[model samples]
Target: MVTGQAVQLDSRSAWQRMRHWAFAHAVDDFYQGLVPASIPFFVLERDYSYVAASGLALAATLGSSLPQPILGVIADRWRMLWLAPAGLAVAGIGAGLAGLAPSYPLVWLLLLLSGIGIAAFHPAAGRDARRAAGDSATAMSLFAAGGSVGFFLAPAVATPALVSLGVGATALFIPPAVLMGFVLWRFQQRQSRNPVAAKHSGGRDRWVPFLVLTAVAVVRSVISGGIATFLALYWINHLGASQALGGAALTVFFVGGVAGTLTGGRLADRLGVLRTIQIGSVAAIPALVALRATPDPWLGLLAAAAVGVAMNIPFAVLVKLGQDYLPNRPGTAAGVTLGLAVSAGGAFVPILGILADHSGPQAVLTALCFVPLAAVALGLLLADPSAE
Candidate 1:
């Protein structure tokens, strides 16, 4: 009876910690979503060319992507709990300053700085989330869903702010980050005072499966990033929808992602991670095709939602699978699967942009249809790490 009570207490504690971590994840990633959300405004307000706008994206990408592995290594070596709060503060401040910058270069620099904060936050937070969530895919899914929710909320928040008050309204966005940072700071302090060690199942790292998983992640990222980059344009240009409707399309897509992330966790818990990923990958191909093939704007919206659900169903599972594959270096696994591998897709966006420039948005989207088939093939190669 005492052991049962202790187990119940531990379960409750784990959920509380996971909730806090999930909130932090949402706050940190909200800044990332801000960049893409703000792009149209930048073009309209500043008359920036596509290449120039993409340059700003490149700055954010490089800042966010390049140093994550190194930071993950550092987190593993030193256990930098403070990075989580510090990262939120820096991300907020940088983004606030970016909105106020007088010149484009300064905007790029500020966004880059904001991206750095975002990069710093992830590995440490992911490591701690794993510690808190243990082997429960459902618990970890909550953390992943938080990020999707933040991304979904970005346009909803930024559109109103930009429309009413212009770019300076970004200042208003800072307070949440500051408040959340303080909350996380207090939580981390408590954690440091009464550290709970995470149990590890001793195992050798499976590089082959990890590499296959990375490939699958890269494909998923490409499809997701491409859709994010082009979806609004497709709605406005191809479907002849209003700009507001274009924004709505993006929001619907992200909402679907949030649903899919949460669903993936439950499915993984029941079906195992590998099978869940395979199902998602296979489903995504047909969904993407359907999205691209639909001519009616309203139908396309539904198709886009379907595509989002199908693509994101594997997201949380991939993160957990990576950690399971490399139990010895979960931080490194998190860094690669969560950070670097995900960012690699952004590199392909420029190519898609070039394709869009020459052919059209529809053509680029059509090309994206083939990516999920590749993901399906890769998914088939991945065995459940737990099984190993």
Candidate 2:
């Protein structure tokens, strides 16, 4: 009975800690979302061309994506808990200041700084969140969903402010960063007083499987990026939907991602992570094919939602499994899976863009329909770390 009570208390404590981490993850990624959301306003207010606007985006992406693995290695070497809050503060400050900058170069620099901050936050947060999550895929899912929620909230939160106040409205988002940074810092202080020892799975690092998993993740990322980039266009052009309905379809797709993240975690806990990923990979093909086939705009919304859910079901699990696959280097695993793999997907988006140019937005969706097959193929090569 005493042991049972102790287990309950531990579980409750883990749940609470995961909640804080999830909230912090949301706050960190919110700034990332703010960049793309704010870009159109920059073009409008500053008379920037498409090329210039894309450069700003490239600056952010390069800054955020490139240093992550190195930072992950550093975090692993030093066990730096401070990076989480510090990075959060930096991300917020840089993004907030971008709107207030007078020149385009300054704006570009500020966003680059913001991206670096985001890069700094993920590996450390992933490492610590894994500690908090223990073996619960559901808890990890909550953390992953927080990021999705942050991203989903960005346009909603930023659009109103940008519309009313112009680009300078980005300054308004700065306070949340300061507030959340302090909250995360205080949480860290409390955690230090009662530190949870990192768990060692006593397993050897399996680079081949980890590489396979990374390939699967990159495939997932490509599909996700492709859909996000083209779904609204597909709805508006191919399906003959109103602009409003096109936006709604995108919203439904994102909301579905949040749901799928949570669902994947729960399913992982029951069905195992590897199996859940396989299911999601298989499921994405059919869902995307349905989206491609649907003629009715309203029905296509349903298909979009289904595609979102299916594509994202492996989202959190991939992160968790990456760590499991590299038990000796959790930070590196998270860095690559969370950072590099995601950014790598963007590199391929241009190919889809070319296809969209030649064929149509619908052709992009048609191409995405077959992309998940690569993930399925790679997934078959993965062995559950737990099984070993």
Candidate 3:
């Protein structure tokens, strides 16, 4: 009876920690989602060219991607609990300033700063999330699903604000970041005082397999980043849809991503991580092809949702699998899987934007159709790290 009670209490505690981390994850990623959602407005309001807009994305990508592995190393060596909360504050301030900046250079810098905050947040937060959730894929999924939920809400939140209040409305988004940051700061301080050692499934890092996984993840990222960057433009420019409808399309995709992330975690537990990734990779190709081929805007929206599910079905599984591949360097694994590999796709969006400049958004999206095939091939090369 006592053992049962203790187990129940631990479960409850674990859930509470997961909820806190998930909420922080949502708030941090909200800024990330905001970047893509806001790009259309930049084009419309500032008369920015597609290449210039993609440069903005590149700035964010560079800031987020370059320093993440270093930050992960720092987190591992120092156990920097404060980084999670501090990063939220920095991200919010940077995003808020981005809209208010007068020059393109200033705007680029602000977004870059925001990206750095995002980079800082993920490694430490993900490491803690793993600790909080232990080995439960479902619990880890719940935490990861928060980012998808944030991405889903970004259009819902930003579209209305941008439409009504203009870019300056980003200032209004800062309070929640401040509030969440403060709460998390206190939470981390308390946790540090009573730090619980994380259990490890001792193993050597498998660099070869991990590199293959990173490659697959990078391909997945390109598909995802390309879709987010161009989906609204496709709807508005190609389909002659309203701005609101374009936002709706992006929201639909993110909603499907939420569903996929949650389902992937459960499937990883039932099947295996490698199998789940392979299945998602295989499924994505058809969905993206259908999305590219559809003429009707409404059909395209449904296809977008399908693409989201197919692409994101391996989201949480990748993070878990990377950790398994490098149990000793879990922070480095999380940094690469969650940050560098994921953001690498965004770094290439400018080339896609160059394509969009000449070939139209459809052409750019059509190119994405073949990316998942590459990911599928890479997925086949990855053996289940746990099996070894």
Candidate 4:
């Protein structure tokens, strides 16, 4: 039997809750890991051209992007209680089929399916998490931390699978998705049995914060995309760093993000959400600037960590902020935070890629620094829930 009425969790229980939450977040890694470990190898093994080989990842992102905002609205409106679970199931099934697909088009179709699966899960998962946390920063920290854990595990899970099953076959390893779905299904059933509480009013005026948050977050996302996409290349090309060291730098950044996110959430709860995001955004300015001028790999890695800490936390906080603004629209806020924020980064990819080509990654990153700085400015003016 499923249950609701807001899960009350202390630190220990919060961790336990997050374990389930993290399982849902891990869905990204399940497919993401395939890019390097399995998909590329499959291309080589199958003698597919570069264009054909790239379809899976490309199609997947596009597919996932399509439904998020719409689905988020649905989630906000109190429809599709089973959406998250069904989404995960779709992703898992898509992965399974992707492995078995014989042609490039088939792979594209499968990846699209997987993307839709991802799109389906995030809004509900995020909204549910926020509700469960009851505005506790620590609880939200636990919630956001699950994504990092998933990201951390992706390579570990997919790498071995790639070695054994080939890229396409590695999709079979995502067991957590199925289990999570079953559990979520149960929870939804319970949620249905008991009528939900009247949600907070999501109003037209909320657009002010929403737009500012989305705009600033997108800028941050661009900076992040620049770093994530090109940092290794930058290190190798400019600093003569080894590939391993570059990878380590990336890992350090992600670790920083995980730590920063948790810290940001806790701090936000205590200091106020806008204040926390403002501080994190300010903290990031120096980090991004330093990353470019520093010559040492160790220093670069340290800076990457700083970026991670600030980058990850702000969005999680923004989700919280969205919830604050749209008490009636947790699902919508969740969707914006998870789907739209990420998409913002994606939207910048082409332009940033062009900038990287014409100028260099440093220039792109330098340009990208303005995002969080803008966020800091916007955050300063933000009215809190108490103010409302």
| Best-performing candidate as measured by TM-score | 3
Report the lDDT tens digits of candidate 4 across residue range 357-376. Answer: 67765666678666676777
- TM per candidate comes to 0.93, 0.86, 0.95, 0.79
Q: What is candidate 3's lDDT per residue for 99-213, written digit by digit as tens?
A: 8888899999999999899899888887777777777777778888888888888888899888887877777788888899999999999887886654455667798999999
- Clashes in model 4: which pairs? 200-327, 200-328, 257-308
Best by lDDT: 3
Q: Flag regions of model 2 displaced more than 4 Å.
A: 1-9, 39-57, 99-108, 163-168, 197-199, 233-247, 293-299, 354-361
- Candidates arranged by lDDT, highest first: 3, 1, 2, 4
Best-to-worst TM-score order: 3, 1, 2, 4
Question: How many clashing pairs does model 3 include?
Answer: 0
The sequence of per-residue lDDT tens digits that candidate 2 reaches over residues 108-173 is 899889988888888888877776777778988988888877766775577678777899989999
Question: Model-by-model lDDT, in order?
Answer: 0.81, 0.80, 0.85, 0.66
Clash-forming residue pairs, model 1:
none
As a TM-score, model 4 comes out at: 0.79
Cα error, residue 156 of model 2, in Å, equals 3.0
Model 3: runs farther than 4 Å from truth?
A: 1-9, 196-198
